[model samples]
Target: MKLKKVVLAVSMLVAIAGGTAQAQAQPVKNIVLVHGAFVGGAGWRAVYDRLTHDGYNVTLVQEPLTSFAQDVAATRRVLDRQNGPVILVGHSYGGAIISEVGNDNKVAGLVYIAAHVPENGETEADNGKKIPNSAHPFVKSSDGYLSIAPEYYHADFAADLPAAQADFEAHAQMPTNAAVFTANIPHPAWKTRPSWYMVAKADKIISPDLERLYAKRAHSHTVEIAGASHSVYQSHPDEVARLIEQAAQHALP
Candidate 1:
């Protein structure tokens, strides 16, 4: 009976040690994902799954595509929930939201996925105006909201995805307030935090050149995915997740 008790105690100690080690191995920082206009947090499933599988706590921010202020507030609400440091990620127009909220003390770094890394006082529309070859001019608006035309989905927005999926995404696209693009960002987080940027070479919604320009100004660690469309987040989840992991490592919790 004494021998049995000794063995059981040893087993319990081993299990406790293993659990502690596993917890320590997990990433210290959490990740908050923000989706751009015309879509919601559902679009971040692939990246979210990948990050969560890797043992990093991840939250997807479904910012109301109403106005920029509301989007920023939604992002902050998620940031406030994190226990330690956070890695804020934005895709497309979602990048703008992260830029506004990344200034929070909880955020350790910023990750832009085929997204706009706008400067303080600059509006999304301002970037659109300078990028003449961009697809912004082709966007349609009604009742103060803007959307991408279905045809552009296969041709430019999400060229990497299957045509059928693109068709569905275009049909279900989120309508964002058209005025949000022209609204100025007062505190651009990229200015203060370390940032990483990924650009889709064939992106149509925003010009590839403009992406590079934003990356350069922000001095972000930048990567370019050739032939990728604006929807590279969906087309290239692994690469996107990899970049976020790198940011988490570089950031201090």
Candidate 2:
């Protein structure tokens, strides 16, 4: 009887260990991407293709850029549709969007790629003033919308991209409302969620120093892509996808 009891106990321990291993191996499969101002979700095509090819359920949020609240609501709508825990990603002004919306219960982790990260009560505009950007002056339309000058867009936003592609991007501009910059995040999700950050070393639109400061403040797992421009996600899709994959792999469901 004693020998039989010992064997059963050992079998139960093995079962428990196997179950734990399987739980740990189950990676987060959903990914939600948010794009910044002056651009739309179309910019995420390359990154989306890569992650989708690798079997991730990648969804992009097409922000209205009408207001900060609308952008956050758009992201929340996308998050609501995710079937399971999601790895949220943002670029440029999109980071501010995620920082506000990532508080959703379905969010497992966050990935910021050359993005802004504002603290409680801080606006991206406030941060911009503290760490001024190198990009050429922004052009404000009569309606109070902003866009980069076509002549300087290539150099300031996509210097790493081919000239032809950058030129097309320049002309395909999506002007953002100036009012969007003045909005502040009340409770940033980065304070509680696991986060990863990629800094574009040569970014001109948003200062790399500010990127570093945000990463450091958030205690995020950070990587630097040397010589990358503000369009790092488009210019270095492989690296950006890999870091996002890392976040997905490690995030708990």
Candidate 3:
């Protein structure tokens, strides 16, 4: 009877120790993902699933795309909800939002996914002008807003994706005011914060050369993937998720 009790006690102790170790190993902070212009938070669904499945807390921001200030405000609202330090991630135009909002005290790191990494006082329009083939059909100006034309959804923005998925995304693309693209970022978070960049070599919407230039200027740790379109998070979700996971690890204390 005494031997049985001893074994039971030992088992319980071992279980307790294992539980403690697991808790310690797990990262407590959340990751905030911001999607760029023409798409809503829904675009990050695949990445959100992957991060959550791997035991990471994640939030995807639905930017208003009305103006740069509005987008940054939206991202900041999401950041305020996180309990601890956060990894701020942006895709495409979302990167510009992160650049402005990522300087918050709560932001531990920044990740740019086929996204812009602009310097202070730089606007997306300025960068786009530098690239010859950066124009998209959906990208148009109405009144004062910038929007993507529905027809160029599959061919320009996401040529590598399936027709149905591309169509769905194009239809779901968010509209950004021209003011957002024209507004220059006042303070770029990449100036002080650690950053990671992913370059989509096959990107047709944004010139691959421009992406490289931004990555180089930011001095960001970069990962290049070939054959991936601008919507890399959807077409190569696992890879994008893994990079995000790595960024989270880098951000952890």
lDDT of 2 at 34: 98
Tens-place lDDT digits, model 1, residues 1-253? 9999999999999999999877655554699999998888988899989999998999998888898889888988888989988899999888888888888888888999988877777878888887745564446566778877787767767778998988999898888898778777777888889999998899988889999998999999999999888889988999999999999887662
- Candidate 1 residues lying further than 4 Å off, grouped into runs, are 1-27, 136-141
Give residue 136's lDDT in candidate 3 (0 to 100).
59
The clash count for each model shown is: 2, 0, 9
Candidate 2 deviant stretches above 4 angstroms: none
lDDT of 3 by residue, 11-44 (tens): 9999999998776565535899999878888878
Q: Which structure among the candidates has the greatest lDDT?
A: 2
Most accurate candidate by TM-score: 2
lDDT of 3 at 170: 72
* Total residue pair clashes for candidate 2: 0
TM-score winner between candidates 1 and 3: 1
The TM-score, computed over Cα atoms with residue i paired to residue i, of candidate 3 is 0.86
**Predictions ranked by lDDT, top down?**
2, 1, 3
TM-score of each: 0.86, 0.96, 0.86
Q: In candidate 3, which residue ranges exceed 4 Å CA deviation?
A: 1-28, 134-141
Better of 1 and 2 by lDDT: 2
